[model samples]
Target: MIKTFVPAPFTTHPALEGGGILHGFFGRQGGISKGIYDNLNCGVGSDDLQAHVLHNRQVLTQTLVGADRPLITPYQIHSPKCLVVTGPWPNGESEQCDALATTTPDIVLAVGSADCGPVLFADADNRVVGAAHSGWKGAIGGVLESTIAQMEALGAKRDRISAVLGPTISQKSYEVGAEFRETFLQHDARNSVYFAEGAKEGHFQFGLPSYIVDRLNACGLAKAEWTGQCTYLEETAFFSYRRTTHRQEPDYGRQLAAISIT
Candidate 1:
């Protein structure tokens, strides 16, 4: 059994600060995973030791909502699906989805990401919270919107909700091919603003955080803001898939962005 554990202080956005909601954008520090996983690797899907991942997740849950409640993060496949969770998944069995919303207090709704956007949502007035994992694929496919829809279904008004995008890949470090940019253009021509010239002639850098927050803001939520921390650049504090790939490492860790209604 895991002993009582506490993690490093996590990042929080002003919009989500101090409410009936307990929320935090966690980094990859203060965990027990070894080697490439290092510390605070909450991804059960990673190649890290199952014991370490489970222990880290338990630490995160305790940090956010105490040890009595459960923290649930579904299997994210870069799709736009969002699940409305009324209770903890049975015995830590997670469903397959990219986002989660809940009216049930004490259940920590979390999303895991490495370089991709980890968005946490809250409507303290309605005692509802949501969390989403939005990679470029999920963002374009509408996972953020899906989360908002579920929140609304649980009595959270769009105008009363606040969302925060946690540490993600910054445009400067996120070079992409022209075909990737075209996917956004085909969806909406105005999305060009999220793309900038990459170092290479045929490549572009994508602004994932900006795009995710923009989509959230367009939903007419009370507030949506990015924590302004880049997972790629903050090597000592966060885990980044792109950074790991660039280094030719075998695997990477995923950080959690979570919210619990109280």
Candidate 2:
């Protein structure tokens, strides 16, 4: 059986309101991908068998999301690109984007992540939803802001949009050299708050989801939250790029965070 993780910190808008449901940050717990990508690896880019990945997605659709709903994910090129999906786009098409938005019911907006942040946004008042994959590049490039604008274009109000960030690599496990820290601080001095002192000399730990939340709040959304789960710290629960590097693994699994209107 597929075990779906539920986001406990977020409150689902009343089902009567026509707003869709958002799932928690899911990890590698239930599919059939073997070796390093074992169990519940939804990333098509991974070396996992394409058939196994498809089966895993099917399991997620039937067990976690309703069987009738179709999940939609973008190509995720770590850019600020956002696509407005009215219906299902081609499945597994690497279209070179990082975000998706839709107002259609039973149309799931999904984002895959190993270390990057998966942000799910919903506006119950307008029945609009969006998802974004926020890596450092995408986040700095304004993917989250672009997603909100796309949702607003679909009739969602900025004040009515609530964004939830799924599990990602927390700061303590995300050590970076001076150049990486300078990249952010040069963009905006306020970004300093998202960095902390790392264990290594002249290095800093970057807070991935914290920056994500800051961007969401700055967009004037109703609420912005993070699940506060660390992918690198929790070996059994999530897949992490840094963790894979530490263990000398070939490739890591990718978890899926999805939301769909019913």
Candidate 3:
């Protein structure tokens, strides 16, 4: 994997600016994988060549933090589980969790997702950071809340933490059946505001990013914003699960959103 092929990640977040912390929302570029995976495919669980996946991970880790620092991501299961990391996990070990929080410097906490929202959190004042894979299920299950709680347990303050949600599928591309809308409404009637009528009957467009940001704000983290990039709509810049499915692709690659305390 050469540097020329890899596009630099789009960095954002007011609290994380000024080199106080290192983070990026990486898309589908800059690696050796071919075919549908293309390049910079960071998902280890994808069926792409394992060697290419490892190389891509190495490229991203080196670019985001440093070649000397360690990068650790969990085996995401869309659960509310959050892990607090003090040190890097051993090679070939992944905890079954949706989010990771850490206070250790140079230890990168990362999460992978294609269509799902990848959230990066930083409490620079407390020297704590976290990353979460927030799909509809994970978001509904309280993954963001759990991540904030875990960060707080590690000395992060709710008011001091800044959360930035990375690129994900937007409402225009996220159509669901009536049952999907009903499920959310059953959880809370207020959640109905997150959905809108679709082009066809018995379907609705879901606003996942807004819902996630609303959750973050409700949790006391005043600073939270989406990058305003839609993975499904931005074909050249992102990998979308719905887009892949609509195209009838065999498999799709996942993107990485990571953060590390300095």
Model 3 misplacement above 4 A = 1-7
lDDT of 1 by residue, 1-262 (tens): 3565665569877898666888889998878998899899999999999999988888888877766567788988999999989887877688999999988877888899999999988888888889999999999999999999999999989999999899999999999999999999999999999999988999999999999999999999999999899999999999999999999999999899988877
Error in Å for residue 220 of model 2: 1.0
TM-score of each: 0.96, 0.90, 0.95
- For model 1 the TM-score comes to 0.96
TM-score of 2: 0.90
Worst 10 residues of 3 by lDDT: 1-10
Q: Which ten residues in a row have the lowest lDDT in candidate 2?
A: 7-16
The TM-score of predicted model 3 comes to 0.95
Candidate 3 residue pairs in clash (backbone atoms < 3 Å)? 6-30
Highest TM-score: which candidate?
Answer: 1
Candidate 2 lDDT tens digits, 165-217 = 88889888899999999999899988899889988899988988888888889
Task: Give the distance in Å from residue 44's predicted Cα in candidate 1 to where it truly belongs.
Answer: 0.3
lDDT of 1 at 164: 89
